[model samples]
Target chain A: MKKRKQRVNSFMVNGLLLFLCLVWTVPTFGLLMTSFRDRDVVSKTGWWTVFTRPDQAELTLDNYEQVLSGKTITLVDSKGNQQTVKGDNLTRAFLNSLTVSIPAVVIPILIASFAAYGFAWMDFPGRKVFFILVVALLVVPLQISLIPLLRDYGRLELTGTFLAIWLAHTGFGLPLSVYLMYNYISQLPRSIIESAIIDGCSHFGVFWKLILPLSVPAIASLAIFQFLWVWNDLLVALVFIGSKPGVEVLTQRLLYLIGSRGQDWHLLCAGAFISMALPLMVFISLQRYFVRGLLAGSVKG
Target chain B: MAGVRLEKIEKTYPNGFKAVHGIDLDIRDGEFMVLVGPSGCAKSTTLRMVAGLEEISGGKVLIGDRLVNDVEPKDRDIAMVFQNYALYPHMTVYKNMSWVLKLKKKPADEIDRRVRQAADILGLTDMLDRKPKQLSGGQMQRVAVGRAIVRSPKVFLFDEPLSNLDAKLRVQMRVEISRLHTKLKNTMIYVTHDQVEAMTMGDRICVMELGRIKQVDTPTNLYRYPANTFVAGFIGSPSMNIVSARLNFDGDTCYVDSQNLHLRIPDDIGKKVRQYDGKAIYFGIRPEHIHARETNPEAADNFFNMEVSVVENMGNEVYLYFTPGNSQYIARIDPDIPVRSGDSHEMWLDTNYIHLFDGETKENLIYKPKTQ
Candidate 1:
């Protein structure tokens, strides 16, 4: 009876999970299908219809090509005037996003790992109080700091530069980054640090040669989070960088492609998929660092 | 190699929990000193203080003649093998062992040579390229040792380095470490809660309890002449049996009078303990000193019949546990002698090796401190 009940429970659980997965993925799958179809077909028919009658809708690469190549497309205005518009392409914006995200991720992790090492191993007066203060900063909302920071940035004439966004992101990401790195660095067997110390390793040497290398999993995992956040962020970019073609990130570019009248909404399916591509690749490739216990054989079982 | 001296060294945490209380010990040059005790005994804390891993709250620690109270661990010139091994997971065995040399800006060739020599000593030459995660527990422990020895530091400190291994492997590593000590000839201090390891490896064993040193003596002297009831009960396997009894005078002969039996205390031991006449005292004897009556006909006194409650047959010898006078005691006897649970048998206590302790202080009445 127990065996039968467990079997029934497991079957129900698997069915529920399968249902939830389909529920979550179906819309994204629909967008992917629509992204491949020609703009006219996308507007006239639902994306799911292509799966039923494969020949009903034609798949073309024109949407992606136009979005990527930055070619100008001619649009007839409502008053019937021909207006030549530069295509809302992500070519420059993609590079802009990389510039923003890479540094935003690398800067915080470098600073945070050092802060974490100090917090975890080095003994100083007010160490606990200082760590608590850093942790307390986690509760302070970024929205509250945005205005004051932007005001300062304006006075400093630093607005509309990648440096502005990088600093803003670093400040915003630091508390949690330090907290995550601290949790990983502190739990490392105290003996390893002590052993290093006894083996003639200076404090800086221990941090550089020991703590940093052992912290790859933590740094890698945090990189994925910070990179994804910075990549998808629109509010930060809009406020700091504005709609400057050269400095705008992918998310801002995608938003701009929606047009002031929302007439360009059709292009969104392809635009959104293009933005989703890198984060998907990032998550898949860097996900293995989440397989914890890199410390497995470093300490006795 | 240089000797280490701890002159009234102490450790008290910020929370005011005192871990080590004014511990004073001198470890001779090139000597192997083992600090052995039960859990919470502060043996590891004492060793950490010597290693400069822990801050000394008071007193001083000197490496050779130089005071190291404020010195950093690296500057103190010591290498420690921790209980968990603590090998760097990201580094290979060779890198782990050679890290300190590289830190000191030693030439690449010298680092390579020293690492290879240490690895060969630890039998880890073939495994040098493998990461810590790829090695087994014992192999990781060897690599940890290799990391320590590569520097050839003046002192070696070990904190229960074999406690993580299985029993057989622990014994193997025990011999291996002793052999390493013999080969290195550096002043070494080791800590463990295992008395057997203390006996087998230490040139002198320092027994501790409740953050204070109970006794420090050579292993043979420690076993034969434990300073107090705690050390007596702690140093030996199967432990010494200690029971409370009344010491009485019976017309020039003295005897221990307990619930189930009365036995004369030999004159030499009696004279030493006679000061406690008519007073409650602890009667102590080791398991090996208790024998089957058939095997020892010479000891006509101190024989009592106990129904054997448990019989442990250890092939060459047997351990028999029984209760007499409501106090449990173990007796080690030849396995060739037949003994069974629930069977009542006569056993003889060799009064020659018996110890008497003052009940209040638990200090061995017959203990004669070694004159240094």
Candidate 2:
């Protein structure tokens, strides 16, 4: 009787997980199918109908080609608003997103790891007070600072450059990054740090060689969260970089696609997937460290 | 190599809790000194203070006649092995051993040479490329030791380094560490709560209790002449049995008189113990000192009837537990005697190996301080 009950329990758990996965994955699958069909067909028929009427479904790579090759497509909105926005430059936007994200992730990790080391191990006056202040900054909303920061950028004459966005993201991303990194770095065995110190390693050497290498799981997980946030962020980039040509990110370009061509499901679906490609690859590659980092400090050897 | 001296060294936390009292010790050059006690005895704290890992709240610490109270751990020229064997989880055994030398900017060839030599000594050449996670517990312990030995520092500090291993491995590593001490001859201070490790490994053992030094003596001397009740109870396995008794005199013969036990004190020591006549005292004897009368009937000066409550059998020996007076006692006897629970037997007390402690102060009445 006990074995039978356990079997039924496991079956229910598996059935629930399978149902949830299908619910989550079906929309992305539908978007993928709609991206390949003709725009007229996507509007007339549901994407699920392709499986029923395979012969009637019109699949093409033209949407991806046009999105990537810089072809201009004009669309008319409701109430006859005609906007002739260019359909190309996503490749350029991808590069701009990289330029914004690489430094945003790298800069904060470097600074936060140092801050975490000092807060965790080094002895100084007001150390506890300073660490509490950093942790307290996590509750402050970043949205409230955008307008004030933008005005500061205006006075500094740095409104249109990628530097402004990088700095904004770094400032906004630091508190969480420092808190997460401190949770990990402080949980490290105190004896390991003391052992290194006795091994003739100065504090800087210990941080550079020992602590940094041991903290790879934490850094990897933090990098993923920050990278995906900056890559997919529309508000921060729109506020700081301002949709300027050659500096606009993927999210800005995707927004422009929606604003100008409200009915072009083919173009919108293809563009959304293009913006998601890098983040998907990143999450998949670092999935191991992500799980380990999340479970750290809660479990012990 | 250099001798370490602690002059009234003390540790007090910011919360005003004293972990270590002001204690003095002198570790001579190339001596293996083991600081031992039960948990919360602050033996590890005292060792850390000498290594500069812990700040000494008061007094001075000197390494080889140089004041090191303000020096950093690395500048003090000492290496420490932690209880958990804090080998870097990321580095290979080779890197873990060579890291200190590299940090000191030693030449590449010299670093390689030293690491290889230490690895060879530890039989870790085969494991040089493996991370700590891939090694067994004993192997990781050897790497921790190898990490210390490559530095060739002036002194070595070990904080319960073998407590993490299995029982068999603990005994093996205890012998190996003792052999390493003999081979290197560096001034070493080791801290452990295991008396077996202290007795087998230390050139001289310092027994501690309640943040104070109870006794410091050789293994034989510590067993034969423990300075107080605490050391007498702590240093032996199946610890020495101590019970409340009274000293009384019938003419010239002095006897330790209790509710169920009456044993005479030897004449040579009776003169000293006679001072405590008519006063409450503590009567202490070890397990091995209590024997079965059949084993050696020739030297049975003090014998008593005890009903055995529990019997633990070993292949070579046996342990018999019984309550003869107010306190329970354990006797280590020959397995050939065939003793069982619920059976009453005549047990012999070797009065020559007994101790008498003052009831109020707990200091052994017959303790004679070593002049050295």
Candidate 3:
């Protein structure tokens, strides 16, 4: 009787969860349908109305191919003279996103984990003051730095370069990354680190061989956050790399799709998917660590 | 193997809290020295200082004859087992044991040989392929010891390594660690808050409190001759019954007076308390020394009139919670000596073994008999 009762309860919970899931998935279904339909169908009828349309007639990968294969171009003027944009294809923007995100995520995490370890274990002059200062930066909106950072980058002739955006994202993301990693790393057993030291590991050796390995869950989770943040970011790219075509990220490319041609809705879905693909992979791979890391700092036996 | 010597060691944190005051201890080569105390008593801190994990605020720590104050923890060549086992969670039991050897760049076969040897000794051969989480608490603890064993360091530090295990397993691991000490015969410093662990394993025990060493002696000596009231009370379970009393010494006969009991001093040893004439002191004796009057009529030093308040029966012995006159104390009695709450009874005081401490300072005042 108890088992049956629990089963019913679980079934109710699953039903509610599926309902929530469908609520979330509706827009995604529309976008998917929008990407497949001709541009006329996307703006007039709801994408769900294509349900009566045959599978072959409704969904097509042609929008995705055009975006991925760098075939589509945007027309600049209504005189019907087409200016090649390559923005609709998403290839350049996708490559730019990888370039910006890979280093932006890696640099801050590497530096933040070191800072976290130092704050967690090492004793040094002004340790608390430095950590407090870093933590204080978390409250500063990233928008506040956009103009001043761009001005500084322009002086260095760095604005519109990938380096400018990478540096901006790292600076903006570091405080929270350090805070998260510190909370996670500090909760690790002091004994484990001490034991490694006693087992003939130096301080660096302890961090590398013991702490870094032990903190993989925390690292993976933080990487996921930073990766997704930099991947989906357009404002930073716009302010910094907006003038630079070669370095324009997918978020920028998607924005250009709207600004240049108000009617090219097909590229919107393809661009969204192109921008989302890496983050989806990252989220799936590191999702378990995300749950584990969040719980580890709060739960104790 | 080399003995560890701490001369006036101290540890003071930056917050101006002193966790370990100046302490002197000489742990003989190959002897297991246990530092036992209540929590926050600096025993763990002292052990960490020895392992070079904690820096001494003042004083010298020497292993064999070399001062190690400036040496790095890794260079100190010490092994430690932590309270929670501290086995690397990511490593298999075999890898965990062999990691230190591998770090030292020891040859693969030699590392394997040492790892296997430790596993055999710990009965952990079958568990080698498993990670720490895959094994039980006791198994994880063995792997911790195995980690220490493979290093073959000159000193071993154990910081409550068996504390996480269940009761039955703690007793079993206690014996195993003791046996490991005998076989390895390296200088070992084990820290724990458990008096039982201190009693069964230590060759010499250092009792600490707050930030100072109260006493350092063999477990037998510590139990018999605790330097102060705290050591006497802290070292034993059921604790020594300490009651406030007037110790009257009229040069010949020594007597202790309290509202609830009048206890005669036993022969021979009474001479020491005899000098404490007209002085207030704490009269102390272990519960097991106190026996039931009905079963042990001759066991009395002097008789106390009281009713039993409670009784706890263990298979071989009984713990009697009794109040004689108005003083409350526990008297451990033989199993056959039956008494329960609400029953009027008398329990004897083996006066010869009685301990006396200064009423104000709580410093021990009586001289203990020489050990056999």
Candidate 4:
């Protein structure tokens, strides 16, 4: 039953944590480094060399200029019409990622919070059976949902659109979001809910006035989880939205940087960091809600 | 305000555990009734049934003659204060106190007014903006009461609301609840496993055990004349000491023998017990009635010799634990007099205050105390 106090001598524990920190930092570190390094210097030397080569300015305003500059990235469609991608190339893609990910993250969370509140508190017939089925969907791989969801909407002529990808992510994200939220919410004090009922609160009153306010922590943490999942997701987007020609996403743009230019990996790195801005900020800010605020109402004085 | 009536109320859980055997009690409008018992006694279940929280299995529950077994809790016109206080942690004290009014769609100004009034009553006006997490246990409890009072529901149900408070606060709130009863004058049913709360706050206390009403009476009556052996022991502090005795009557004289003690019954008991001359009975007395007295030849009615076992001084009063010829008893005596362990002190029984029960039925054979 003893826990050995970890020391610097215990290299494995410290090393794993150090290694994870390094793993986490290296990419963002690379993106930050690549954003500043000159085009030729970035291609020829690893980002680690900026430390040894004191003569080279790894950081510059020109990389920033080229990245921020509005340039047309063109794609020839099946009928061979060239469409110009608009805005600051990175700025346009940032908007595209926002359009796709925000709704993808929000639609599921909004729907799931209601579903979770219902699953945890409501007493309609077949509710238990349906809730169990919904949670069971958590074990379902998102890849399994992609084809059927895309094909069903594809028949309605909805494929290759952001709506298709958003709906797909919503469907994919809802199961796990509801499952996570259900666990957090089911632990709320029964007495408070019952007292709410006695206090002239209808079920909706309980949901809106009692549950929604109390569920902030659960909803916040779940938002972070679902937001990050949909934001970082490549497969769902790639299958539905990314493969489209004119409406290329940030990940698609980053992917093309590797294929067409192959040497413009710094631009790709810059593009990836721009896409990650919201989720990273959101996860960092709202992460504390996951610590344990839902228990506050349950174990009152 | 509304009175409550439960007619043939029954509760059978989904798991088929029948918690409440059928119970029927009419709680008067604007009166305070307490459902008191040991844990698992179904007193809480009964209260919940009346509160429209627990679904009844049979018969009817009425609030102001309205059949409410099927009414939604919000529509039932009842407010409940939970044992743990069950405050909404995310809400400020003001919001918690104002929730019911807000739910009722009361005007902002009115909700504010009523909440402030409740806060003033509970001495929590300064704590209105704090969440339940930041407040002390007593403060949170006041907010709960505040929530209930804001609704001004036709009835109030308290499920061991004071049990979560400290001993001192529990006693203080006990008095406060009684005062609140007079101020608000709504039908209130309280549930607790603590007998003292039942005795102090209830106008009519229902003492329950194992899903059945053991006894229902006023506190004074329950103390002076418990209906059965269970109530006899359950209602009192330090409990009523009971000893089995064999009754014997010889012409005009009567005696009861309990192995070691052969005591002559008083003329009143000595008269009633005359018919059951050869029957077995229980002899009971409250600790306060047993007194230490100077032996006098003429004071035949009150004298007995005690083999003192332990003397406990609780500052103001001394508790004498002694065996009088084999019957173990406690005597709450004046502390100014010195008594020690292993000393034989002459003690007196206020014989008129003793109780007798039939050993088989456990029913009180004594006449009831006069109504206050």
What are the Cα lDDT values of the candidates? 0.89, 0.89, 0.83, 0.80
Off by over 4 Å in 1: A1-16, A71-85
Residue-level lDDT for A206 in candidate 1: 89
Q: For candidate 2, lDDT tens digit of each residue in B275-321?
A: 78899999899999999999778864688888999999977889999
Candidates sorted on lDDT, descending = 1, 2, 3, 4
TM-score of each: 0.95, 0.95, 0.92, 0.87
- Per-residue accuracy of model 3 over A3-115 as CA lDDT, tens digit each: 99999999999999999999999988777778787666566676767776555345677777776776466577888787876534577778888999999999999999999
Candidate 4: tens digits of C-alpha lDDT, residues B1-372: 889998888899989999988887888898899999899999888988888888899879999989998998888888899988888877788888887887788999999889888888888999998878888777777788888998888999899998888899889888888888888888999998888888888899888889888778788989888988888889988788788988888777777777656676778778876777889998788888887784234566546676789998899898999876656898888988788899988888776778888889877887653322
Q: What fraction of the genuine interface contacts, i.e. the true contacts, does candidate 4 reproduce?
A: 0.72
**Model 1 CAPRI quality:** medium
Across B1-372, the per-residue lDDT of candidate 3 in tens digits comes to 899999899999989998877888888999899999999998999998998888889999999899999998878878888888777877788888998998899999999999999999999999889877777878888888899998888999999988888899999999999999889889999999999999999998888899788888888888888888899999888999888888876557778887777777865767765667888889889997877777666563576767788888888888988765666788888888667688988667777788888888888887543321
> Residues A114-162, candidate 1, lDDT per residue (tens digit)?
9999999998999999999999999999999889999999999999999
DockQ of 2: 0.46
- Model 1 lDDT tens row, B170-287: 9999999999999999999999999999999999999999999999999999889888899999989999988888899987799987786687888887877767889998888999
* Native contacts recovered, each model: 0.94, 0.50, 0.52, 0.72
Per-model RMSD to reference: 2.2, 3.0, 3.3, 4.7
Give candidate 3 regions above 4 Å deviation: A1-14, A52-62, A70-88, A259-261, A291-301, B249-251, B298-301, B324-326, B368-372
lDDT of 4 at A137: 87
- iRMSD per prediction, in order: 1.1, 4.5, 4.5, 2.2
Candidate 3 chain A has its poorest 10 consecutive residues by lDDT at: A292-301
Prediction 3 global C-alpha lDDT: 0.83
Question: Positional deviation of B91 in candidate 1, in angstroms?
Answer: 1.3
Residue pairs with backbone atoms closer than 3 Å in model 4 (clashes): none
